[model samples]
Target: MNRWMRPLVWAALLGTSVAGAQGIELLPGTPRPLDIRAASPCTFVTVMNRGTTPATLEGEWVNGVNSVPVAFDAPAVPMCEAAGTALTPIQPQRARTVRVKVNSAALGTLLGRRSVLEGHLVLRAAQGGPAILTPLAVEKPSLLGRTGVQRLLWPFVLACLFILGVALRVRRALGQEMFAAEWAPEKSWGSNLALITGLITTVGGVTKIAESVTPLVTLTGVVFTLLGLAAPLLYRATLHSLAAHPDRQAGPVWGYLLASLLTLWGAFGGLITLGALLDSLANRLSGTSDDLLGTLVMVLTFLIVLAVIVFSWQRLVQNIDEQLVAAPKRHRQSALL
Candidate 1:
C-alpha cells in the first residue's frame, strides 16, 4: 500500500464507474463468456441502452491487449436482421439480447491451457458515435455440452410415445370388421401417408435435438407436420361416415374404445407435432426468439380441443362401466328365473 498510488487507484475506480453508468449497461443475468470445446461456440449476452436518445449497436469482437479485430459470427442478435449492417437498434433504456458466436479456431489459439482469453465487445452507435466496450472472458474447457442434447431427449421420448399410441389406435381400429372392410378404398392412401409422415416427423424432430436440419429433414418434416394436422379431420370424416351406416354394427364397446383412443390421440398428439413444426419454422425465421402471439393462439386452441376430447372420453368410459355393471345384474336375474 504505497500512499501516493492509493489516491490514483480511487480516481481510476471512480472514472470506470462514471463511464459504465453513462454508456450501455450490460444487463444483469447476462451469461459469463462460456468455455468453448465444440467447433461452433456461441453464447448469449444482453445489454441495455442507458442513454436518453435511441441508440443502435454495431458490434465488434477484439483481442483486449493487442486491440486486434477478432473474426466472429455476424447478425448475432435474433429477430433484428435489418438489411446490410449487423446493427441492432435499441430504444433508450430497453434491453436486448445479443447472440455471439466466435470462430473456434481463432479463439482456441488465443486460449491455451491456463490462458484466460480476455476480449472486448465494442458496440458503436449506428449514427457514427464512440464505441462502448464490454470486457469478455471465456475458458477453453476440454468438453462442452451446452447444446442441450440431453434436455431435448425428453421431447424425443414424448414423440416416440405419441407414435406408439397412434400405432395401437390404428391396429385396434383395423381389427374391427366394419372399419377394415371400408378402410382400403379411398381413405387408405391418406392413412398410409399419415403414418409415413408421422414417423418422419418424429425422427426429424429427434434429429433436430442433436443436429441442424438439412433440406431432406426439412422437406420430410413439412410433409409430416402437414399430415399430423390433417389426420384428425380424416379420422373424423371416416368415423362419422361409419357411424351413419346402419349395416356397420361394429360392437359398441370396441367402437367406443377405438373412437375415444383415436379422437383423443389425434387431437392431443396432432397439436404437439404441429407445435414442434411451427416452432421449428419460427426459430428459422426469427432466430431463437419466440412467436408469442402464435404460441398463445396455439395454446388456447389446444386447451379447447383437449377439453372436448377429455369430456367425450370420460362419457364413453362411464357408459362402458355402466353397461358392464348392468350385464352382471342381468345375468344374476336370469339365473334366479
Candidate 2:
C-alpha cells in the first residue's frame, strides 16, 4: 500500500468499524465529538429514524477519564415548518435535530492528573434496533490536550514499549528452540552488552521515525496497545536452566521435530499479531504525516521482519544438523587460533 494510503488501511484494520445502523443514521459530521472543546459543548446534530415505526431516542455520554461532573444531552428538538419541537419521537422516514449538549461544568470537576474529559454519546432508539456511537473529547489544554507532547512524542514512547514487548517475546521463543537443539550458549559479558545495545538502538531508531510523523491526534488508539510482555514471561523458564547446565544437551533431532516447528510458529505468529495491534495504536496517533515516502519506507521494513521470521524458522527446520555442525567447527577454529 502507498504510504499515503497504508495508514488508512491499517486504521481500518485496527479501528473498530461500527456497522451502519439499520434504523438510525447521524448527520452534521462537522465539529466531530473529539474535535470540539468544552468551550463549545453544544452541537446540533440531525438523527434520522429510518424504521417504519416512530421511535424515541435515548443516549448517554460515557466518560473516558476522571468523573467529569456532567451529563451529555441528546434531545430531539423542533425542526422544519413551525420550529424544532422538544424531545419527541420521530415518525417513519422523518429526522430530528438533536441538541447534543455537554455540560461545560465538567472541566472544573476533572482531577488535574487527567488531560482530557472524553466520552462517547451513544444514540439508540428506545424501541431498539441498531445504535450510533459518536466519540467525543473535551481537552484540558493546559495538560496533554490534542496537541503538544502527547501528540508529538507520546506515540513514539508507546511504540518503544510495544517494540520491547515483541523483542522479549521473540527472545523467549528463540530460547525455546535453541534449548531443544542444544545450541551452545556463549556465557560472557559480550552477549549481555550486545543484547542491551541492540535493544536501545532498535527502540531509538523506531522512536525517531515515529517522531518524524507527529501530530496524528486521536483517542481511539488507547484501545490498541499492551501485552506480548506479560505473556512471554508467563512461559516456563526452561531456557535459563538449560543454559546453566550445558552438560545435559538435548539431541539436535529434537529441534527438527514437528513439535518444535509448531512451537516456533505459535509463538512467533501470535506474539507478532499482538505486536501489530500495539504498533497500530502507535500509528493511531502518529499515523498521519506530511512525508509520504518516509511513511511508505517505514512500512516496507515489515518485509525485513517477515524475512527474519522465515530465516529463524528455516534455521531450525531446514538445516538443523548443518547449523549444529557449523557451530562446533567455528568453536574449534577459534580454539586453534
Candidate 3:
C-alpha cells in the first residue's frame, strides 16, 4: 500500500473499534433535568473507551459555582484487563456504563429553572497527553413573553394610498379641459417660478423618502409633499398655455403664484415630519435618546408649515375663481375694440 493509504486503513480500523466500544454516546443521551423540588439531585449516564490501544478514561463535571471539581468513581466491572499499574485499558470491542450523581446544590448552580448552563466535556488519551472530543454548550430555559407586531400592515397601507392618489390625479387630468392652452411671455415667467418651487419641493420629498425609517407615516409625508409641489406646477403650465392664445382667457397670475407657494410649504412640512419620524425610529432601535431636541424642533417646523399651506390653498382657490369670472368680460371688450 502507498504511504497515504496506510494511515487511511488504520483510521478506518480505529473508527470500527471505537464504534463497537461505545456503549452510549453522551451527546445522544437525555440531559440531566432541572427545576425539581429544592432538595432533589440530578443524574446523567455516559460511556467511553479507547479504540485501537489501551487507554484510561477520567472525567469531572464542573458546576457554575466557584466550588472544587468533583470526579466520578470507577464502575465495578472489569470488562477489559489492565495494561499496567495505572488503570484498566479498554480493549477494542468492549464497553461499560458510567453513571454520574450530582448533588442538589450543584444541580441548582449548574441548571437552575430559568438560568442557563455553560460548560464543556473533555476526552483524554491514555499515553499521558492532551484530550479530544471536547464539546461545549449553553442551555436555555423555556421562554414566555409577547411576540410583537405582524409584518404585513405597512405594505398594505402603502398600496392603498398609492392607488387612491393615482386614481384622483388621473380622474382630474383626463376629465378637465383646463390643461390645453398656448404659452404667453408674461405667463411663462409665472410658470418658471412655479417650476422652481416644485423642483425644491420635489427634492425635499425625495429626501424624506430616502430617510423613511417608519413606513406608513413617513411615506405619507413624502407622497403628500411630492403631490403638493406637482399640483401648482401643473396648474401654472396649463394657465400659461391657455392665456398665450389670443382667443383664450388666462386666469390671474397671482392665484397660480399663491398655489405654488402653498405646494412648496406643504412639501417642506412633510420633509420635516418624516425626518423627525426617522430620528425617533433610530433612537428606539439603538436604545439611545440623543436627538430629542432636534425632534421637537422638527415637529414645530411641520406645524408652522401645515398652517401656511392651508391658508395659501384657500386664498389661491378664491383668487382663481374671481379671475375666471372677470376674464370673459375683459376678452369681450378687447374683441369689440
Candidate 4:
C-alpha cells in the first residue's frame, strides 16, 4: 500500500472498530425493565469502545420524528474518533457508560399510549461520525388506568343508590298516610323525580354496557333515542305535577329538596351521557348537520336540567322555612287561648 493509502486503511479499520464497539449495550447491572414510575429521575447506560482503538465519544438524544439532536456534555473518557461526528474519547477495550435523565414529558412522548417509557439511544464515535442507534424501553408503574366518563360508572351508581335509600327511609319514617296527605305536592314531585331518575339510570346503564361490548356507534344511536324519548316525558310529567300541586309540607320539605337536588344532578349526568352517545352515532353515520344538531340538543338538555334543579331546590327551601316559622307562631297562639 502507498503511504497515503496506509493511513486511509488505518482510518477505515479504526472507523470499523469504533462503529462495532461504540454502539449501545444495555448494562447487565441495570434493572431489566427500567422502572420509571411517577415523575422521578431515570438513567440509561451504553458501553463505548468495547473492541476499538481509544476514541472520545460524544452523546446526544434525538427526537424520532423530526431528528432534532439534543446534546449532552460528553463524559470524560478515551474513545476513538470518527470523521464528521461529535467527538469524544474512549479507551480501547473499555466500555463507556452514558447516563441519561429523562423528564416526564419526554418519557410520555416516547411511551405512545403505553404506560411505559421507550425511545432510542443514538451513540456516536468520539471523532465525529454517524451514530450507532439502539432502542431503549422503560416500564411505567401501572397505577390506575386513564380516567374518563367510562371509569365513573361505579361511583355514579353508588351515588344513585345512596340517594334512593335515603328517600325510602324518609318516606317510611313519615308514614304513608301523613306523607300522602301532608306533603302531597312534594310527594307527587318526588315520585315523578324518582321515576325520571330511575329511567335515566337504566338508559345510561344500557348505553354504557353497549359501548363496552361493541365499538359500533349505531348501537349508541338507539340508546340516545331512548334517552331522548324519556327526557321529554319526564319533563312533561314533572312540569304537570309542579303546576297542579304547588304546596309542600314543612316537615318533609328538606327530604324533597335533597331528592330534587340528586335528581337534577342525575339528569345533568344523563344529558352528558346521551350527548356522548349521540356524537358517537352521528360520527358513524353520514351528514354533518345531524351531528351538529345532536350536539346542540345535548347542550340544551344539560342546561335545562341544571336550571330546573336549581329552581326546585330554592322553592323547597323557601317552603320549609315558611312552615317552620309559621308552626312556632301557631303553637304560641294556641297555648295562650
Estimate, for each residue in 174-235, the C-alpha lDDT of model 1 and write its tens digit.
34322211233243332343454456555766567422333433444454445434544443
Residue 208, model 4, lDDT: 52
In order of appearance, the predictions have TM-scores of 0.30, 0.30, 0.27, 0.32
lDDT of 4 at 127: 63
- Model 1 clash pairs? none
Show the lowest summed lDDT stretch of 10 residues, model 1.
328-337
Top TM-score prediction, candidate number? 4
Model 1's TM-score against the true structure: 0.30
Q: Write the per-residue lDDT of candidate 4 for residues 1-337, one digit (tens) a residue.
A: 4543532343353343222443333334432333444333334355656545665545433333422233333434422121123325556666655444444454443422223334444556556555554445455421111223332343245335544544454443322211111223234443344345445445545565333223322333333334333433333333212233355322233343343434444444444444444443444453332345545555665576556555554543334333332232222110000
| Candidate 2 clashing pairs, residues 3+ apart or interchain | 78-84, 78-85, 79-84
lDDT of 1 at 90: 71
Clashes of 1: 0
Q: What are the lDDT figures for the candidates, one per model? A: 0.44, 0.40, 0.37, 0.40
RMSD of candidate 2 to the true fold? 16.2
lDDT of 3 by residue, 1-337 (tens): 5643532443353342221233322334544433222222223344444355555555434323322232333445422221113335555444544433333344434431123343433334435433322223333221110010111233224324433443343343223332222234344322333334344434544554333233444344444545454554565554544545666545344334434434443444344443444444444554543445534545564575456445534543333333343332122111000
RMSD of 4: 16.2
> What total of clashing residue pairs does each candidate reach?
0, 3, 3, 28
| Ten-residue stretch with the least lDDT total in model 4 | 328-337
